[model samples]
Target: MLLPRTFEALPELPKGKQIQVDFGELKVKNSEGKTVKLYVIVFVLSHSRYKYTEWQEHPFTTRDVLRCHENAMEYYGGMTEEYVYDQDKLMTVSENGGDIIFTDEFQAYKQDRGFRVYLCRKADPESKGKVENAVKFVKYNFGKNRVFHNIESWNEQCLAWLKRKGNYQVHNTIKKRPIEVFALEKPHLREVSAPLSFESNLGSSITRIYCN
Candidate 1:
């Protein structure tokens, strides 16, 4: 029998060098008091543990992923050099011989944005533990026992909570407020000249429109 090989500990990432992205689903009551499922996209800076989140009423497509990514970068006031992700369908199509094949839309977006993509190996959740913990934190701390009036209201409250609690609170592992660390990391991040464009596919050619 072969023994599993151990890997070295991950090194401390440079500020604004890497960001991890993930998505989670939450079930909550809407304005009509009917239970509905919502999808949340989360992005976490590797060095500072700073995070950003956005909610969608339905499952995300490639376009949605692109839009969320742009929004997250804007929220952080810049972009990172690398982005890590799981084997999510919206971004990844396949893994052929250790090479990841990203979806066309994601590939296009990556080309336009000019950032490296890193996909965690299968069953290796620990590789992206920061964003994974962010998802869990949002579900347990922000979503637990919460009464949401609607998607809009939930998002509004989420932003307020992020400002008051999530970003300001001291992280257990880092022992520092994310917002404070983020302030230091902001200068190292890459600047964006303009907003990203969202493309619509109609028959053959694609039409792109800028979004705020």
Candidate 2:
């Protein structure tokens, strides 16, 4: 969402300006032949189309989201000036008339990072399509018809797939591999900082992460 006014403070958003974030899930069979669901957070750098995806066996909670953000930034080697999102309940309490009250924990994290946010309208796809497509890509290209041995194996497979095809293949719109474009965009992104001390209030924890 490269909308006006909100970013007037900066002359213009740099190439490494926004990373679109979205949630998705896939159903697959485990070794026991029982079906299970894996939740995912798909991140796409708007400038490069470079992507990092994290998966969990259970649905994602606020803490998982926060920790994934760290891993995504680390994967990119830095953070962007702003993040683009839809009306995800994980971060926002309400979007009533655009008042935009964020969850207390997310609000604190946003302030501490000193980055900006662009919240897309509910149910709107155009604004954040890159990541939405990424979610689908993960489902069809990687997760569909694939065996889920365990969380660790699924992630390791995804990582190898990302390196082999997901980020390496030339994107239809960009006409260049995401990694190639990301090389140019990376220098302009904000430097990665020490991880924030966000912990889970939820009882569960993620076992493995692909990035950092």
Candidate 3:
């Protein structure tokens, strides 16, 4: 026999305290006039609804994941105290009895950067609703009807879109432009004392042992 869990309201998050991350896929035409699937990783500040996105030609490896984190942090000009993620293998290895076993590379990155990691429970997309909507907004707003010559052009366009549309538009829930909200949140963000070197080849393996 099993007991049902009680419902609890989501906690109110402070500025620069939490960020939610998710990945979405988009199909775009290449120079050869064939469609290619591109992975778009999204990071959203939970308190301000500010976001950063990166487009990649392939699914993310551990190295790519770290690089993306660095890029997002750079765009935001700081880091948050906690990162919320789904059960993606790149970040998490398993959920053992309510304890999260994170991937080695990500664990090292978290320890090195000194931020906490929070994983949403299985099948609970609402736990990270901000980033989930960000994924959809990117797919429908920026990605739809867009064509790219190559990955480089796609990335350039993404930054342009972020400037012209994504961050500038008033968010429905927040009722303010992300840029405006981010301005208030910016002062609360943690400054990185030393940045990670993405050039270094961190070992990549889906089978890497999880760390508690």
Better of 1 and 3 by TM-score: 1
Relative to the unseen true structure, what is the C-alpha lDDT of residue 66 in candidate 2, on a scale of 0 to 100?
86
lDDT of each: 0.83, 0.82, 0.83
Query: For each candidate, what TM-score against the reference?
Result: 0.89, 0.86, 0.88
Clashing pairs in 2: none
Global CA lDDT of candidate 3, please? 0.83
- lDDT by residue for model 2 over 70-165, one digit each (tens)? 888888889998898887889999976758999877887788777898998756677787777888887889899898898988898998999999
**RMSD over all Cα atoms, model 1:** 4.8
Q: Where does candidate 2 stray beyond 4 Å? A: 1-14, 200-212
Q: Assess candidate 1 and give its TM-score to the true structure.
A: 0.89
Runs off by more than 4 Å, candidate 3: 1-12, 202-212
Worst 10 residues of 1 by lDDT: 200-209
